[model samples]
Target: MPEKTIPILPCRTLQPVLDFYTALGFEVTYQQRSPNPYAVVERGGIELQFFAMKQYEPAVSISTCYVLTDDVDGLYQAFRAGLKETYGRIPTRGLPRVGPLKDMTYGVRQFLVTDPGGNCVRVGQRTGGERHHGPAPQETFARALHFASLLADSKGDPAGAAKVVDRALALTDETPTRVQLLQLLVLRADAAARLGDEEAAVTGLARAAALHLTAAERDQGRDALTRLADLRGSLRP
Candidate 1:
């Protein structure tokens, strides 16, 4: 199965969004012109698709999608400089509902800006050098499931990580994608072990190990399980 693409925002205008992303140094990885044109802009492991929507209003939506960048300041600076060089003003600030940059308490330096058509876009930089992007998902469920791992690792908050995994499990409960579901289970188990929740760790690891984790993923999970087992084992003898 091919990896799933994350939907960025439902867009009515393609040219402006395309131009905006292009100006931000994002390259188009995929583009289709028919039946509802769209484009996927990607950099590093980040992939986001802009879908053409006939409705131009900003509907209440959970995620227009998130962009994790290693160089938040540099990207912001670059965009600021590009705007100055092109239009003599920052294109971001002029947008409606946009605000000055603010440092988030979660250690993520980020800012929000509205697109030309009122879609909210967030650009975040994970603090403490933690990676926010992970392997691609084979489906939407898997993508969301994998996102839990990234969120946990990115924030360095074990509780937050566990919550994301639980959310993913709940969301994927009815029709779970094996790869992602198992991966998330393992991640949650790891988080549980980190928090010294022995019972939860054992249950999570047992469930994950029962699933046929991919060779590489299995190794990762096994390593994590081993560490947890060792920790628990030490207290026994």
Candidate 2:
């Protein structure tokens, strides 16, 4: 015996849904206008179906699907490329956006994608990690990143992530190293930018820039440094 499952989510309309999924390289497997408005899209083995509700609002829709895959990075890259090619830039920080890939404290590395219909697609791969119930009371750089990533990447709540990072920086007793500080500040800046808080973003990036690091430290934090640069580029007027 064999079985398969597909999510049928609600959308305000089907045209934008079709356009968005097609842009992400999902082929239109089926569509219908009779009986009711419906469409189906497929990418590899994954299939998603959408039903139209004329009065439905995608902004408030909480419909979602979980995609478990071994190649999280590859899928993210493909989606990112497709979105950028179609829109001339990848949309982030809002509906119809693809979030940056992140590894959470839990046993998963994932990316959050919000479709045009505001349905969420959480793509993740399992990794060895201690699954915890809630956020820890105490603050540390690592704990901060974990919590922030959970909000910003997993839940698409950059505002919450920004608050978490700010609280950690102001309250941490972990004595973070320069590289760690740089990483935290970069994330803070990113979250702020996503929230349309340009001043906070500038302040965070400037603070990160002011931190001194040895060559080895720079090498150790190349990823954060690169993101810092990208944030600067995005912040330009």
Candidate 3:
């Protein structure tokens, strides 16, 4: 089967966009550096890419992306549960309300979610579709790295966090997860700064800032830039 690619356009917050996908079980597959730095994530045969833009103003455009699955109902339940657990309310009750889980006329059972940036991520699995589920070999490593990074974050262990990131990089030749890499870099920056290696911290943050230098990434990278500056000021003698 031919691999499919989906485009993700975030108005200004690339980091949150990346976090949202990772939280939903997608794996980062590629990162581009030129002609614009973008990221590729894959779930099964479905691949999603981010098209970072300098300025993205919100609009009521119907940008839809399809996610393939073997259990549409189970997936929908998980999605609803996630929203409730994170926001303390059912996702169907308010703005960006969760749409119902129903079988479309086209033979796919799906539910829709409007991302914070206003993109619709449609999750679906075929009716009567048997669950042939497990992470791809590559995803297993990617998830491990992600989990370790989370653990490192909560435990204040930058060294351990860095190790996980290194493992993630090793799994894929190029992780188009610039935002995720930047985050890990930020963690490393904090870890380095705390451990008395101000130079390393600056270097990590600088690399992250440099990522935003592209036309598409300028605004996306600004948050990291501002954050780094704050760190720098705090570390000054």
User: Which candidate wins on TM-score?
Assistant: 2
TM-score of 2: 0.81
Tens-digit lDDT string for candidate 2 (88-180): 666765568776566666677777788878899999888865655445536477777777877776676888998888887897456778887
Which stretches of model 3 miss by more than 4 angstroms? 1-3, 8-10, 29-37, 93-97, 127-237
Residue 140 of candidate 1: its Cα lDDT?
57
lDDT comparing candidate 1 with the true structure: 0.59
Positional deviation of residue 201's Cα in model 1 after best superposition, in angstroms:
54
Q: Write the per-residue lDDT of candidate 1 for residues 41-126, one digit (tens) a residue.
A: 87666666788877665434333456678777666666555544554444422232222243443557665555554566678787
Error of 1 at 21 (Å): 0.8
Instruction: TM-score each candidate.
Output: 0.46, 0.81, 0.43
C-alpha RMSD of each candidate structure in angstroms: 17.6, 3.3, 19.3
Question: Model 3 over residues 17-131: C-alpha lDDT tens digits?
Answer: 5555555556777866568767776666666777667676434545666777888767666665665565554333112444545434345666666665556777887764444
Report the candidate with higher TM-score, 1 versus 3: 1
Best-fitting candidate, scored by lDDT: 2
Worst-scoring 10-residue span by lDDT in model 3: 89-98
